[model samples]
Target: MTTLLPNYLGGRWQTGTGAGSALHDPVSGQALVRVDATGLDLPAGFDFARRQGSAALQSMTYGARAALLVQIAQTLQKHRDAYYEIATANSGTVRNDSAVDIDGAIFTLGQYARWGAALGETRALRDGDAVKLDKDGLFQSQHLQVPRTGLALFINAFNFPAWGLWEKAAPALLSGMAVVVKPATATAWLTQRMVQDVVDAGILPPGALSVICGSAAGLLDNLQPFDVLSFTGSADTAALIRSHPAIARQSVRANIEADSLNSALLLPDAAPGTPAFDLLVREVVREMSVKSGQKCTAIRRIFVPQAVYGAAADAIATKLAKISTGNPRNEAVRMGALVSREQYQSVQQGLQALSTVTQVLYDGRAQPLIDADPAISACHAPVLLGARDADGAQAVHDLEIFGPVATLLPYRDLAHAQALAERGQGSLVASLYGDDAQMLADSARALARSHGRVHVVTPAVAQVHTGHGNVMPMSLHGGPGRAGGGAELGGLRALDFYHQRAAVQASPEVLQALGL
Candidate 1:
């Protein structure tokens, strides 16, 4: 049996004095670790981190912090060869799926470190350059960044143990703030291991990173004003935490990155057997399979024009039937299990509910689904759908069935396509596929008002495109409406939410003279 990964607090391994819960391997359906979740000394844990870790991190310069971030990325990359196994044990995702969350997260942090280094320029940090002041030479200033003088809380989802943590923690660390990470109870082991590796690498200053493995049950209750909390999970959970009157009363900065009803549009131009048609099929398959369809960024809605609805559905069905699902180690396996039994049930529930609004074009319900593999903890086969009414559109538009499932909807016209995509209310991403640039651009402009991110993919640009599955470190990974109007990436802009920027004034001439 695999032993538990201990929680790290104040730069040390901490195991609570109680027999905790067992975390089973998602791939093997066996116990991986028995975590110590109860009796976590929260008051003591928070106190130690705030009193020591927070202060130490605040003293570091941005460059110093940036360098440390680079170091962690390199270290994590080195140890990442073994990460696939860890991910498989907890998530049951195929290698490709795991990479999207594990390796992808490491690469994202490396990118963030590079971007943060551009803050200082020769003109700003050099000795001679200056900015013109107020007319009287009495007021002038240069903008600079300071580490936010508070803490950052990361409450992550079970589906992405590594990505969720790194996306929030790395930026906060590089921006010079202490981080208190609360991993989900169901899948905290991988996060625990990763955090330990991060600490052992010595990238974090002592007390700068703290781990609370179990029940963050009451952690949010103690938050204060100006303190920042970033969460990546359910909208309901975010609602509960942000609703804690303390949040509004104190104006706490709560950033939520939840999965919303996102869509990928197959424009009227996608003729059967055309390149755009093929690209649309590939795009939908990739999103549904990547991360086992457990990503907040997954495309849950597949919108097709009324003329090609039959063709699109047939193409998707053919592709869905060809997908291989089973163990992650099985290289031929393009799709893998959902995160857990509970996750499997959740996806099933979503599909059952969506059926109420739409018809299943390809159902895995009595079919040979990946979930049938008893060796895995929670595996499910791919499911394809085509909807007939607003019931179908509204079901997919409203509910995010987080898994390898896509609900294809038909539209009467371009306006209707845009309207159907909008019915999801708000989304993180809305993708349109066509070789016609003008048409895609026009549709995007019309629907851009409803989505946070837009992608226009066509035969000409398909090879060079990042594809719909990739979320860059510099791009915003969230949306408005049911998607929880918040952002996770956008370079230093993400860090901005963590730090408070106050303008201080002094004349340029006075400042220059003082230096002399």
Candidate 2:
């Protein structure tokens, strides 16, 4: 029998009332554990965080909180190997992919911890200098940032169980807010284990962090005006969260990072055999294979100049053909299975939709598996498709495959490429490859209006530049329109989401006394 994973609530781990749902290993198709939260006391959990956890965190100075964050990072580092083991079995991710999620989480926490030292021990963060409100200058006003006296609720996606949780938890904790996490059911083992490790260490005050492993049936209904929800998932789910009566009426704060149809454009100057051409092909293949193209920021659409469309497509196909798919435990396997059978079927449905307007360049169904049975395992072959008509294939931009798949489109010129990219509505990221400075600059400026980050890769920086799919902690990772217009992880600016800004309209003497 597999172990039953309990939910953390009210300062203790509780075995809730239910039969529990079984979680499986994607590579072997075997049950590993059962998790359930049917009878979790939702209201009491939030109340404990608000009335007790919030108080304990608020009593500490920003520097003290930063110290706690650093301790958590250190603690996780000691137990990092255990997490990678679970991720490979449960998430079907290769070792490199697990490092991206597990190591990336620890690195992000460390960065935030060091960044907090600069904030000092102040409770109230002064936003700006006092402004003269009157001619005499006796009356002045200054903006002050104070921690919210509430809790933070996080709903994470399955692709990144560890990083998804810590990325939001780090900032919320640093800003003096308690956290309640709801990880995706398909891959909650890693998340639940990480949270358990932190809670068991006793480094954080009781109720500072809690996890709900199974159903979140009544979680959102208990939210208050002061509470904040940071969600990373489908856009349809984000819309539902926004329209919830409790969320809409109480004016509860919510930040959404939704899946988008991100694109990469190969400039006209990046002709065949050039460095820029090779870079674009290599980047696209990497994005498609890494994590099996399950990333929200993965390149879903590839735009190439009309002159070399066939060459670009052939190059990407050749690289993708070289990837070996199978059990993550195999040292020779380059790509692994999907997180679950449901995700595999979802990827199939996307392929069906795109087939109506595109032709297959490469089909995964024909690929050979290594060290795993293709019949029972959840592995999927990498697929590449070409638009039958670049100007009319709306599904290419509107539908999200969410797997190892990408659609190639041909563009006439720079303006045409920019227009084709904008058709995505908006994207979390867009990459442009070229040797011409003017073309790269022009496309980047136009793409910036729609994409959160525009990565420009020229022949000069191709060797040293960070790849297109990476989401750095120092940069902004949100986008406008279909990408969900919510900014996250923008250096120190991320703290604003967890703090309340208030203007102190008072005399200079009064402001000084208030520590402005």
Candidate with best TM-score: 2
How far does residue 465 in candidate 2 sit from its true spot (Å)?
A: 2.2
The CA lDDT of each predicted structure is 0.76, 0.90
Number of the predicted model whose lDDT against the real structure is largest: 2
Candidate 1 per-residue C-alpha lDDT over 208-250 given as tens digits, one digit per residue, 9 for 90 to 100: 8888886645777767675688887888887887788757688
Listing every candidate in turn, what is its Cα RMSD in Å to the true structure after a full C-alpha superposition?
3.1, 1.1
TM-score of each: 0.92, 0.98
| Clashes within 3 Å, all models in order | 4, 0
lDDT of 2 by residue, 1-516 (tens): 889998888899997699888899997899999899988889999999888888899999888999999999998999999999999999999999899899999999999999887788888789989999999999998999999999999999999999999988898999999999999999999999999999989989999999999776978899999999898999999999999976889988989889789999998888999999999999999999999999988999999988887888889999988999999999999999899988998999999998999999988679789888877788998999998478899999899899999999999878888888999898999999989999789889999999999999988997788788887778888998888888889788889999999999998889998854
Model 1 TM-score, 2 decimals: 0.92
lDDT of 2 at 457: 93
Candidate 2 TM-score, true structure as reference: 0.98
